[model samples]
Target: MICSHVTVPVMIHLKLHELPAKHVLKRWTRDARDIIPPEYLRYQKDHGPLKYSSR
Candidate 1:
């Protein structure tokens, strides 16, 4: 994750088992886009699937 204009260096990284599901991700995406400005967001790039948790 790279952002030139950042408040916090990062958000806490969640483990794969802790990640949100598709429906929740969809809703969060919608809500975040609604509140967060376009400039702050910038471009997005998926890094492929997360490392799977053995747990």
Candidate 2:
């Protein structure tokens, strides 16, 4: 007898036209928090607003 593991790819669907900016931002923050450390949160927060600014 042999044991085998199978992997499946899951597809996610999103309709951006129906989503609000605040909703998107909330999701982004949640995802980012999982990958970023507490000490870096302040730097990350600043970058979000400055991203659009040339200076």
Candidate 3:
């Protein structure tokens, strides 16, 4: 008996116009959480914002 490897191509259909507003908001919020460290965000949240000194 002989065995062969088979590769399959995937086809995807996306209709952006058909998507709802809530789905966009859900995806945006999910992506936003990982942009920065939680501790840095906590410091900003508690102490207003970071002050940068330019040299």
Candidate 4:
């Protein structure tokens, strides 16, 4: 997805398959808003913010 923010560069070659692992791993090292897809975020709205958790 494209990052409009000045700090983060636009991700041009992103893949959909990559998302599942990131979600399972709960990638704390990266920015959630930047990495995760908007559609997934919208679908998961009931689950609260996509933050890393022990549980």
Candidate 5:
């Protein structure tokens, strides 16, 4: 899943051993923020004239 404004790139590479539904959710929740680029935080704070898509 790609984040709004193209700030984050999330790739899900699942191995057969990690197929459990609960484990998948846990992994995704744990790593979600790490996928986002640092610059995006700055942009969010600025909230200047530039407008980003909300998706």
Candidate 6:
């Protein structure tokens, strides 16, 4: 998972490595799950990068 790669415990708890809350937060957060497929990335390499807001 993305959390495992980060230096700090961003997504999950440090001790248990679980979600801190049961429900989504009401406020908008920059922290979000982003998964880009290899095919699309390769295409972008030859072509230009896509103007995507988020994944």
lDDT of 6 by residue, 3-50 (tens): 345624554444655544543452334343234455556553345756
lDDT of 4 by residue, 1-55 (tens): 3224721332334523333343344455444555777667755544676666798
> What TM-score should be assigned to candidate 4?
0.20
What's the lDDT for residue 54 in model 6? 79
Residues 1-55 of candidate 1: C-alpha lDDT, one tens digit per residue: 3342441333343323333353254436645555656554444343354455697
Window of ten residues with lowest summed lDDT in model 4: 6-15
Estimate, for each residue in 1-55, the C-alpha lDDT of model 3 and write its tens digit: 1111311111113323333454345335646555756656755444566666898
Model 1: ten consecutive residues of lowest lDDT: 7-16
Model 6 bad stretches (over 4 Å): 1-36, 39-44
lDDT of 5 at 6: 34
lDDT of 2 at 51: 35
The local lDDT score (0 to 100) that residue 6 gets in candidate 6 is 69
In terms of TM-score, the best-performing candidate is: 2
Q: Give the poorly placed runs of model 4, Cα more than 4 Å off.
A: 1-26, 43-55
Model 5 has an lDDT value of 0.46
> What is the TM-score of each predicted model, taking all chains together?
0.18, 0.21, 0.20, 0.20, 0.20, 0.17
In model 5, which regions exceed 4 Å deviation? 1-30, 43-55
- The true-versus-predicted C-alpha distance at residue 8 of model 4, in Å, is 32
- Greater lDDT among 4 and 6 belongs to 4
At residue 34, candidate 6 shows an lDDT of 31
Candidate lDDT scores, in order, read 0.43, 0.44, 0.44, 0.48, 0.46, 0.47
Give me the displacement of residue 32 in model 5, in angstroms. 0.9
| Candidate 4: pairs in clash | none
Model 6, C-alpha of 43: deviation from truth (Å)? 7.3
